[model samples]
Target: PSEYFKGMLSRVGYAIFFIPFFITYVGHGFFSPGWLLCPGFYLLFLIGLSLPTALLNKKLVGTSLVFTGLLSGVIVFYQVNKLSWLSWHKPQRQILQIIEDVGTSQTKTLQIFDCMAAEKNATSIYRVVGYSSSIQEIFWLNHKVLPEIQILPCSEAGRSVASLTPNIIKLRWSFPEFTVLTH
Candidate 1:
């Protein structure tokens, strides 16, 4: 058992460096549930797999190590700078614009609902809100208490929910794909 463990570690030992990030990401999720599938987790997994393959090939280990180091450095720099390449994508930008129009305050909590609930492993709307605002807390309306603000996809159901909801003033933003409801 000890030999087998050692053999396994010898090939993929570099993965140990990613454990802390994975733990931090998981911890963050508990406080702010978001993307069901984290890209960072998969990136680490691929790096681990590549590490072992590079080691087995012998000729690639040094080059792979250098490339990995550069990649990690770039990622660290981007994170430290608070740059988000993925956040600016079209769908994300649309959602973010709606979140921005809803506005936020340090003390308020926001809740969002959408077709995301229909997907098996849906990304939490809170995550999208978090990226665009400084609101302290956000939740999904999926089996949770209704919050002051609700966001839904621009659908008939969304319009009906907005119209039926009390104490909410529907915002007049033309988000061709989403609806914003607020108090």
Candidate 2:
């Protein structure tokens, strides 16, 4: 790359590094997996910039190789076992399983109370950017169209359930815990 091109790339790298901060200021403070791409690009930029210097010293080359190998190993391990380590994934999966178990042909709609509230209070890392609704997160995770699921506030649960038909299933959600209500 020419000097101008290298300078432009460096500037781009700095811009990429500050993306999360800009996003946080402009939008909801939710960090999603897509934000990771920025850091990945910055890492590549750094590695590319340092490659020439690293190649000049045999010891530095060896150290860089070792570090790269270690980083690769850690990344592979995380990818392989991410489901177990990601705290929110298990509960989300379990919630889906529960819904699957209880859902049937006769079930027309599924209503979850306090879901939005729970999501707002949640400290989960796996949040969908720009949405504070667990319903969106669930949809993103499953990538499937769920039954007509409505998220209602806890205060409206009684009123909503009272007006519900027999075909609708009501569920009370308090973060990791779920209660299926039988009418």
Question: Which candidate ranks first by TM-score, i.e. highest?
Answer: 2
Tens digits of per-residue lDDT, candidate 1, 1-183, equal 354346545656656675664576664533221232244444445544544443646756557656766776666656533423244254455554544454233314344444544431223444443332332232222223333554545364455554554434343223123445554
| Candidate 1 accuracy as lDDT | 0.44
Candidate 2 local lDDT, 71-183, one digit each (tens):
75566556434523355555566566765565355665667776545435533322411122555455445545445667667787888767868878787765445677753
TM-score between model 1 and native? 0.34
The window of 10 residues in a row where model 1 has the poorest summed lDDT is 134-143
Model 2 steric clash total: 0
For each candidate in the order shown, give its overall lDDT on alpha carbons.
0.44, 0.56
- After superposition, which runs of candidate 1 have C-alpha atoms over 4 Å from their true positions? 1-16, 27-88, 99-111, 124-147, 150-177, 180-183
True lDDT of residue 183, candidate 2:
35
Model 2, residue 56: what's the lDDT? Answer: 38
Model 2 ranges off by over 4 Å: 1-29, 33-37, 53-85, 115-147, 161-165
Query: How much is 1 displaced in model 2, in angstroms?
Result: 16
lDDT at position 166, candidate 2: 83
